[model samples]
Target chain A: MKLVPLADRVVLKQLEAEETTKSGIILTSSAQEKPQEAEIVAVGPGGVIDGKEVKMNVEVGQKVIYSRYAGSEVKLDGKEYIVVRQNDILAIVED
Target chain B: MKLVPLADRVVLKQLEAEETTKSGIILTSSAQEKPQEAEIVAVGPGGVIDGKEVKMNVEVGQKVIYSRYAGSEVKLDGKEYIVVRQNDILAIVED
Candidate 1:
């Protein structure tokens, strides 16, 4: 099933954390305490104000930093996706 | 103590849920399964785009609906607040 975010919400897929911890240890998902990173996959058109539409600034394919506790978890096509508002995005990874 | 969102994020205070439950029972905070509502208390200036600043569409005093799991929990002045981006705000209560 397809999930469409209403307003300026965006759907993101969690990115696998970097392998090899700073201490040179490989951490698996089970060992991680939190998921703080994700990759943008879909975005909604900007919200409407006075009949005018605001456009979203973030685009698909960007890696972003979001609050470790933000967004609703949904399962789409058996994969987990997060639905978050565009503003919840803290920073975009340049690379 | 005050917490400032870095960008277009907003700080919200969770509102007390209605007293009477739909089933005619009083639902206290403990009885509730989720907190899905809040009131806007502080908002950040919109994010920068192409050297121009985007203004936030939300304002203080407006009640809003957000994803049940959106935002980072923080404490200020002994009160708890949730920091979320403006886009995570789904709807504003008219009253």
Candidate 2:
């Protein structure tokens, strides 16, 4: 089943890690760092949350940088996803 | 200087841990659990935060239960305190 976030939550799919350095040196899997970048998989319909009015600013397919250790991990359909509040998303990645 | 919370933040001082159980059994320091109970030391004047209008619902001197691992620890004047948002408080304790 697909994930449907509620309230101010947003579903995100993390981007793959860069295994190579700028100098074209390949790094091992253990040396790769968990990337903070992700793509919006599902956008929650923003309304009132915790007695405060909230509005969704990002859309599906938009790349974003989220706060470290901010969201919960969910495994669905053999794929991993993250569910976080809209505020946890720090910024939208441009280009 | 005393902590003055900003926005909907609240400063809390954790209550002392109970060293003895209700059964009159005294527990060692390592066996004692960190208490979730705290006394409200300061309350912020609620306003718009993250583009959402918020109103403060808590006041100083109130005893409350806060969420675990929710807020940041701050040290002021050699005193330790936790600074958390209003929503991080789970419930008010009445005695």
Candidate 3:
């Protein structure tokens, strides 16, 4: 099943952290702080919140940075996704 | 010293958590999930991001809700604040 966010939330797939440094030494997962970078998979339709219309700004396929401890990690169809509110996103990673 | 956020960051002073129940039973700080509500203090002048100008939508003195684990807890002048990017704010509380 595909992960989808409701309300002002977004579903993001975690981008894999670098496994090696410039020298090419493969580091284990334990050596990395869990990467907070993610690719947006889906976003909730903007809803009226507190009498104001909150609009969805980011689009699918956009990369974003989020607070390290922001969202709940979930697995769907063997893939990992983070479900977090749009505001939990720190910045859109322009590439 | 006051806290000022650079770029799209915002300085927020956390609102107090409730310490009692309807029956007038007092609850300890440990018993409450750390409150995620805050009052905006200073907002960064929205800079050119993604080649698009992101304007400030919320103003100072507005109350907001944030992701529970999003911002870094900071203290200035004996008062507590949270430093987070604008995206880390979920919604403005209309009062």
Candidate 4:
């Protein structure tokens, strides 16, 4: 099963955050910073929000950055995903 | 001094958070949820970010909602401001 966002929400899959330092010792989970980067798995259809015309600019399969501590966490089919509004998406990454 | 957001950055002044309960007792700062609503003070001239062209839809003097735990904190002239990318803005509040 996949997530489909409604309104301006988007579902993202977290990218692997480097847990090891140059010395190759893995840091404890509590010592590591929260991951902020993700790959867009699904995007919501943009529409009117608070009577304002809102549009979605990000597309599926795009790599995006967001605030590390933001967004609601969801666990689906044993996979973790983040659900956030369009505005929480900082930027779309590109080559 | 006023803040000028470069690129898609936005400067916002946080709204007052209610710390008192119905019993008229005040809660500690740590007990209060992080402010997620703000008034747009200055908006960046949105342009290309991460090779994607972005546009600013929120205008000055507009109330907006954002991720509570996100954004970089800035203090200027005895006032506090939050600087976030345009995408970090969740929604524009209506009248």
Candidate 5:
């Protein structure tokens, strides 16, 4: 089953460690650090959350940087994803 | 200087650990668990944050239960306080 995030939550697919890492050296998946970069796999509908009106700014397929300590890790369909509130996202990664 | 929260931020004064623990046994301050309960010391004006409109639902002197891992601790004038977003607060505790 696919993950459908609730209000103000976005589903993110973490970018491959080697792809985002600035360091030329490549590390195995298990050895890679917790990269803060990720791609928006699924965007949640922004609505009233905790009495706050949230508007989703990032669309699916956008690369973004998220807070290191934010979000919950979920393994679905053998793929790992992180579900975080829109506020947890710090910025949109530009080309 | 007094802490003035900005944009839906709330400054909370953590209740003494000994007062919150229900266990008949008493523990030293250093050994007490991270109490999730606190009293609201100051409230921020509701406004736009990250493109979302937030309204503060809490008031000063109200006891509330907040998320365990939420907010940042600040030391002001030798008094410790926690600064957290309004959403971090889970519920109000009424005696």
Candidate 6:
């Protein structure tokens, strides 16, 4: 099931956990920890302002850094998804 | 201690719980229940756009309805505060 955002909303998939431990302590997903990073999957065609359409600044496939506590967590088809506004995106990751 | 947001940020204080029961169940703050409404306390001078300053659309003392899961909760001076972008505000409540 493909997820699509409506009206300036963006869909993000949480990044997979790192294989190595940050402090020599390997952790598993079952630990109930939330990932701080995510990949932008889909974005809505900008929101309307005074009858004008404002395009989104971020693009698909961009790795973004957002506030750890931002956005709503939704489980769709057994997969976790986050829905946040473009403004919630703090910075785009560059590699 | 007053909180002043920076760069289009908005500070909000959660509304206190209703004294009565919602569904014949008395729920307290200790139940870990998150509030769905808040009052806007401070707003940052809007974020820069093309070097132009865009004033915040919302005003102080406005009751805003935000996503139940949006924003980061912060504890400062023993008071709870939420920091969210102006865009995270879904709607304004009218009395």
Q: What TM-score does model 1 achieve against the real structure?
A: 0.43
CA lDDT, every prediction? 0.63, 0.67, 0.63, 0.66, 0.68, 0.63
Error of 2 at A43 (Å): 0.9
Question: What is the C-alpha lDDT profile of model 6 across A25-85, one tens digit per residue?
Answer: 1211212222244689899887574355555777899765555445888898899989987
lDDT of 3 at B83: 66
Give the least accurate 10-residue stretch of model 3 chain A, judged by summed lDDT. A23-32
Pairs in clash, predicted candidate 3: A87-B87
Is 2 or 6 the stronger prediction by lDDT? 2
For candidate 5, lDDT tens digit of each residue in A5-41? 8888999998786665552222111111122567889
Interface RMSD of 1: 11.2
The interface RMSD values of the models, given in order, are 11.2, 14.9, 13.4, 13.2, 14.0, 11.4
Q: Global CA lDDT of candidate 4, please?
A: 0.66
What would the per-residue lDDT of candidate 5 be over residues B1-95, giving only the tens digit for each residue? 35556557787888886777753324232333233788998887757786566788899999887763546654444566666678888789887
- Please provide, for model 2 over A1-95, each residue's C-alpha lDDT reduced to its tens digit, 9 standing for 90 to 100: 89999998999997665511221222111111222556899999988787777777778997664544558999999999999887666445443
DockQ of 3: 0.03
Predicted structure 3: lDDT: 0.63
Give candidate 3's error at residue A40 in angstroms: 0.6
Expressed as tens digits, the lDDT of each residue in A1-95 for candidate 1 is 24445577777887754521332433233342333577898787775632346679998898787654446655433466666778788788664
- Candidates 1 and 4 compared: the better one by DockQ is 1
True contacts kept of each: 0.03, 0.02, 0.00, 0.00, 0.02, 0.02
**What tens-digit string does per-residue lDDT give for candidate 4 at B1-95?**
78889988899988665511221222111121232556899999987777666766778897665555558989999999999887677555443
**Per-residue lDDT of candidate 2, residues B1-95 (tens digit):** 35556557788887755622322433233333233677899887767777668899998998887763446554334456666779888788775
Clashes in model 1: which pairs? none
Q: What is the lDDT of candidate 2?
A: 0.67
lDDT of 2 at B6: 54
In model 4, pairs of residues that clash are A87-B87, A87-B88
Model 2 misplaced regions, further than 4 Å? A19-35, B1-95
Error of 4 at B77 (Å): 1.0
Maximum-lDDT candidate: 5
The RMSD (Cα, Å) of candidate 6 is 11.5
